[model samples]
Structure formats: C-alpha cells, structure tokens
Target: MTAIPPLDPPARLLMGPGPISAYPSVLRAMSAPLVGQYDPFMTGAMSDTQELYRQVWATENDATLLVDGTSRAGIEAALVSLVRPGDRVLVPVFGRFGHLLAEIAERALAEVHRIEVEWGQVVPVSLIEEAILRVKPHVLALVQGDTSTTMNQPLDEVGAICERHGVLFYTDATASLGGNPFEADAWGVDAATAGLQKCLGGPSGSAPITLSDRAVEAIRSRKRIEAGIREEGDESASDFVRSNYFDLGMILDYWGPRRLNHHTEATSMLYAARECARVLLAEGRDAVIERHRLSGAAMLAGVEGLGLTVFGDVAHKMHNVVAVEIPDGVPGDAARGALLDDFGIEIGTSFGPLHGRVWRIGTMGYNARKDTVLTTLAALEAVLRRFGASVPAGGGVEAASEVYSGAAG
Candidate 1:
C-alpha cells in the first residue's frame, strides 16, 4: 500500500453557494469521540438534536429528526414514503433544485405533472394555485431556494394554496433554511428538509427533517418493518417502497421511543447537527437572518459597484447567495479558477441554463460576515482586473464598506 498525505488540505474561504465554511463549533462537535449507537449518551444526544432541529424548523411536530445523509436524502425519505406508485405529484420547476425534486418524484414512480416557469424567477402563486385546482395532486413538492438561479421561492401563499386544495406540501429547504426566513408550521408546510452545509454553518452529512401530523399520516400508510424482525402476520405496506435506506417510517421508529434497530446512527454527524442548531438558537435566528441580509446586500452592492450586472429577479433573491452575470470580456471559469488558486477563495459556478453565464457568490452561514463579504468582493475585483476586464481599483471594497456602515447605523 502506498503512503499518502495525512489529511492536510489548504484552508479556504468558502464564499460560494453551499458547503460554505463550516462553523468552528460544528467542526469541534464532529471531533468528539464516538459511542455505541444506542448508548445512553448517544440517545440523549439524538433526543437533544431532534428538539433543536424542531426549533430550527420552527415546528412542534414530534417527527422532527435527522436523516443520515445529505439534504437530498431527507427529501427522498419524505417523497418515497408519501408518494405511492400511482400517486399524483405536482412539481413546479423553476431552477435546478426544483427540477431535482420533480426527478426524484419521477423515480419514485409518481404520476408526475410539472408546471414550468423560466429560470431566474419563481413560479407565481396564481400558477401554483391553478395547477392545484387543475391536477389536484396528492403532493406538491417544491424547493424553497435554488442556488443555481439564486432565487427564493415565496412559499407562504403556495403553502396555503396546497392546504386549501387538500394537497400535501413539502419543500426542500437545503439552500435557504438558516439564513432565510422559513416558517414551517406557520406556513402550513407538511414536510420540510434541510442540510447542514448551507446556512446552518456545518459540513455536508446530516440532514434535518420535520414532518407535520398530516405528512406523518401519509407516510405511515406505507410503513413496513424489515422481514428479519417481522412477527408472523405483522402488517406491512400493500405496495412496499423501492428503497429501505430512504424509508422514513423505519427511520421514524429509530428516532422514536421504540428505538427500533435500523441503521446505526451517524453519531458524529448528529453531534455536528446539534451544535449547528445550538449556535444559531443561541445567537437568535432573527439576528442571524439580519446578519445574512446585510452581508448579502453588501456583496450585491460590491458586484454592481464593480460595473457587473446582477442576474435574476432582485426582488426574489435569497439572502445568502447572489447570481452575478459574467462580464463578456472575461472568461468565467478562468476567473473562478484564479480566485481559488491565487486567493484561496471559492465562488460557485452556475448550472443548467445559466451555466457559463453567471457566477454565484454566497454570503452564508459562518461566512455571512462583514469581513468575509468584503474579502470575497475585493478578491473578485482583483481577479477580474487581472483578466483584462475593466474594474475600479477600490470600488468594490468601498461600496461594501458603505453597506456595512449603513447597516451599523
């Protein structure tokens, strides 16, 4: 066997869309020694984590818990458990993540009906309302924020619409949860899922999920215990879900009082997830949202000050990330590479329709600070100027500083 390097990675300022710098406390939590999955301390940590995520999700549901994978894993668990083979699912695709929701539903063998809107914008409430009235889907699965297009879909009215139409409303909050305003209960969301990587200020691994009473009822209808532990005549789902790992019913039992043996819990990730919520709740969620709001505004101002156009509908932009149009004279990928290689800062590249046309700059989680925002803007200005693009020397920094000053005032 060859001897390789021992986990030495360059320290980077991750000012991009997601997986942005993990919170120091979160990383420390992940470093704690492991214990047996069902150890008293371990179960206590899991219970604490569940309670904390309930606060984070702003819900009182008993089903709020953590899934053992990324944000998408939580989404899959909710969908496969809710959508039967022939159930109707309506997905409104406006950006990459929304399309992802639709695709996952399709793979679940849902009778999928999609309502489309152009990228860089959100589907209007009226359109969603119309879709609900017309198709009358069993579930309406949507994404609250799509990093690819840098837009936050307004979920308040849509949730109400789904409720009025007797549809289960689920949202993937992977990209917007902590830094943005998300009212899972107030908005009548039946199920919501998020990851630690984005606004929660942690690495990608644990997924926080919450299920309303209605959603729990829907999932329980398809519940099935594993055959190994099954008693004779034990009731199982009529049409069993295709996946066991993404099975929410079994996961619920594992997290519930039953503590039924499913997969061994990811203890380190559970610790990290708990700490992330602890830090946010300690700082206060409203205060954290205000911080992200200020930082995002600063970055937007800095980019516009550098004579770059902002992409998408500014009115609907997320508080954590911005999509800036790549200047015609500069090579988008080359400039992004320069920023990373020379400055050790990461800015995201766009995807799908906006690919090669825009750079997604993020001010989120632990990085949503005045200094982080200013550093990213300054580095971006330098990279653009180096690439022979016309940019003012101190314009970006000055504008961002002004935003900070105004915010302080």
Candidate 2:
C-alpha cells in the first residue's frame, strides 16, 4: 500500500466569491490548544466571542451565538426555529442565495411565496412592500448580499416594511456582514446570520447569528428540550423544531449563561471566529467597511479599465465581489484555469443565467486589499492577452491606482 503524504496545499490568492484567504491572526488563533467544552477558559472564550459578534452585527441581542455549521446552517436554523409548518414566508429573489432562503423555508414546511426580479436586478422595496401587503407573510427571508449576481439588496427600507406588516424579518448576511453596513437593531432586523468566510476573514465552519426578542419569542415557542435532557415539568411544543442540529433555540442555550450541552463545540472554529471579530473590531467596523469599499472600488475600476463590461446594476453591487462580462472570443473556464495555473490566482465562474457569460471576481475577507486588487487585475490582463482578447497594457493597474490615490487626495 502507498503511504499517504503530509497535508500540504498550493498557495493561491483566493479572489473568488467566498472562502477567501483567512486572516493570519485568525489562522494562528485556530492553532491554539483546545480545552474542554465547559472549562472556564473555554466558556470564557465562548462568552467573549458572543460579545464580539454582537458588535459585528451591531446588535445588543443576548441571543447572539455561534451555530456549529456553515452559513447555510445559520440560514436553516433561523428559518426552522422561527417558522412553523404552514406559516407564510415571503422571500424576495434577487439571485441564487435568495432562492436558497426560499428553499430552506420550504424544507421547514413553510408556505413559501416568492417575488423575483431579473437576475442582475434587485427586488425594489416598493415591490416587496406590495408583496408583503398582498401575501402577508409571517416571515420575510432575504439575502443581504448575493455573490452570484454581485448584488447587495438594499435592506434598510425593507425592514420597516416588514415591521409595518408585523413580519419576522430575517436576513442571511453570509456574504456581506463584516464588509457591509449592517445595523441589525437600527435596521429593525428580527434575526440575522453570517459566516466567517466572507468579510469576517476566517475559514468557513462556524456561523454567527443574532435574534431580536421578537424572533427569540418565536423560536422559544417551538423549543423542544431533547428527551435525554428533559427535566420534570419541562414541556415540548406541538410544533417543535424538526432538526436537532440546526435548532437555534437549543444552540442558544449552549452559548448562553446556562451552558447547556448540545454537542461538542468546534473549539478551533470558535477561536477562528473569535479572532476574526477581534481583528474587525480592532480596526473598527466602519473603518474595515471603508477598506472593503475602497478595495471593491479599485477592483471594479480595474476591470472596467481592462475594457470589460460589468454585469448587474453598479449602484446595487456588493462591496466584496464583481461580475465582469466574459470577452466574446475567450473561453471563460480556460482563462480562469490559466490564471490559476500560471499566476496561482483564483477568480470564480458564474452560475445559472451567467454560467458562461461572466467571471466573478471577489475582493473579500483577507483578500480585500489594494495589493490583491492590483495583482488580480494585472494577472487578468495577461490571461486575457494570452487568450487572444484585446486588453490595454497597464490599464487595469493604472485605473486601480487612481482610485487609491484619489482616496488619499
């Protein structure tokens, strides 16, 4: 039998939509020695992480905690916990992730209703209000940022619309939380969830979530203390949350002062998530958001300077990713491969209506920097030239430099 080799991976600049390079500090944090789940230090670390994420989400909800899974897990937990079977859930579909929210709601047995706009467009708040008035959904599940179309759906107004309709507002901020402006409480968000992989600058695993009192009330109404832990007089609801692992109510207990055992916590990921928030808070939230905005602006300018057309509404595009139209003669996949093989840089391919038509370039997490933007643009220029596409010499870098310098000015 052949012996397995040591785990080693190639170094690539991950300028794709998600799972971008983790922060150096976050990586170091993950390597720290693990302790027992209920150990004092472990519990302290968990408490600290919860507090940190509260700032990250800009909310004071005591229920802010980590879900022991990916961003999708956070989405499902929020949906299943708050939505009972036969409850109306209205999802505004702007891109792929929006559909994901609707699908998750469906799995939770929600009577799902969808209002969609074209792929590159956002669902207007007025349209959403109209839908809310008509459908009168109990929950409004929306995606804050959909990486698929590089659109950041404006959420400020929608929250009020939901509030007016007494809808439990939940947003999946997996792709946009740290880098975008998300005022969970001020925006009247009843529930919100995010992952570390995007703007939080960590590897994907743990999902940070927050719940308003209204959302907590909704979730607690369906809480089922597991049979093993059921105490005398403890009662289970008729509409108990179906999934044990994705039950936010139980997960909240595990993170809360009670420290009730649910599952063995992923200590490394907890450390990673902690450090990710520490790094963000140290830089200050608004300052970090500005950095992402500047980096994203540079990347967008760079691509446009390369004579590439951007896909979607420029005004509505997220500050972390951009979709550029693929040149007519160049093969999208091959060019992406060349960028990877030759330059060790990874941009992303499109999905659905954009499969072969556009390339998704991301400036997110640790990769949201001036240097990464400039390097990606340079590499993309060379790849385009090699692929027989006409690209201006030094155009991408020069344009990006202008944005940086303009900011300085």
Question: Model 1, range 118-178, lDDT digits (tens) per residue?
Answer: 9989999899999889999999999999999999999988778888889999999999999
- Model 1, position 256, has a per-residue lDDT of 99
Residue 299 in candidate 2, Cα distance off native in Å = 0.6
* CA error at residue 204 for candidate 2, angstroms: 0.4
Question: Tens digits of per-residue lDDT for model 2 on 246-289?
Answer: 98888888888888888999999999999999999999999999
Looking at model 1, the pairs that clash are none
Residue 283 C-alpha lDDT in model 2: 92
Q: Which residue runs does candidate 2 get wrong by more than 4 Å? A: 228-238
RMSD of each: 1.6, 1.7
> Per-residue lDDT for 4 in model 2?
100
Please report how far candidate 1 places residue 390 from its true position, in Å.
Answer: 0.8
Query: What is the total number of backbone clashes in candidate 2?
Result: 0
